[model samples]
Target: MTAREQTEAYEDIPGTWVFDAQRARQGYHLNEFLYSLMKAANRAAFLANEAEYTRRFAMTEAQRTAVLRRDWNKLLELGGVSYALAKLAFTDGKSYQYMASRMTGMTEKEYVEMMLHGGRSPDGWRSRAERQGRA
Candidate 1:
């Protein structure tokens, strides 16, 4: 079986690991967004036309080579999406919420809610909600 198939198969194995199906699905969706953005004509042209994208987000020569070879996990481990989005926002006036929505199939409002609720991090918004007796 392919690597992806093997990974999928592992999901069915009970007690194999701490599996979060929702998080896995979200990661998959985010990867798809990164792939599409990397290949999009408009985005490519925009990157090409905009000097700052290259100046800020383009990987180093070694990183570029690694990314070109589809080393996705490595790229992510090295701060791929986060780095790229931060650079894009800093140089292009885009917001992380907008970028996160674009990358994760979530709406901007949803992204904001998630951020506010600490859904994106370990310390979730539950505490704040609880403080307000909304939890």
Candidate 2:
């Protein structure tokens, strides 16, 4: 398959977002803003004025919205890398587990239990088309 075809195929997977080169470029500014939270002063500034701080980055409006909303799924859909997003979570005084649980639409306790029990079942829909009965 051609590179474009392969990328299209990757998009078929359910609940999965590939951080490919395209995504890396798309998310460059967003990731940079997120990574900036690594510094205490930046974190404080972001916490003090989220919209203002976020505006400093040249991210798409959708990406800006996702970041402010803390919409983990939407952020991922908009190319936000998980590792970089973790910085935002940390800045909020939240744990990676908490952020992950929110991403999976589960409570922290439920997410923890699920992990302890070996994670999601392999029997579920593997692709979007499969779930739609169109595969």
Candidate 3:
């Protein structure tokens, strides 16, 4: 099927990405590298030579760059699943809040405050289709 055919658009729900089957297939190798972190030796080896580990996973250039740059949000945009990505964060001894804060362009305190306020307002956060409709 074509990309457009496989895609199903929905109303904007900020900071959410469904890890469906298509994403699962796309993320398999990346997830595999994250899961490998369950083993201390593998985790250590990866930290020692990130480029080598990335090459072993056969990650795309974009994915590899995201990994090297610690760009969690970009990794997700490139099809990395949240749960799978969590493993990478854990391997680095980082908390979920830290990762989420980074991904959302907020400090940990700001992220907490937003969550306490029931997340970001959706008032002006409509999807592209919605914006076009308004115009």
| TM of each candidate vs. truth | 0.32, 0.91, 0.78
lDDT of 1 by residue, 1-135 (tens): 976676566554332221245434434433333444544563665456543433344345544443444343344433355644344343345676675565556788888888788666423323444435465
RMSD of 1: 13.0
The residue-level lDDT of candidate 3 at 17 comes to 66
* Best of the two (1, 3) by TM-score: 3
Scored by lDDT, the top model is 2
What order do candidates take by lDDT, descending? 2, 3, 1
Better of 2 and 3 by lDDT: 2
What's the best-to-worst order under TM-score? Answer: 2, 3, 1
What's the TM for model 3? 0.78
Error of 3 at 99 (Å): 0.8
lDDT of each: 0.47, 0.92, 0.78
Stretches of model 3 off by over 4 angstroms after superposition: 1-6, 10-14, 121-135
Report the Cα RMSD per candidate.
Answer: 13.0, 1.6, 3.4
The Cα error of candidate 3 at residue 121, in Å, is 4.6
Backbone clash total for model 2 is 0
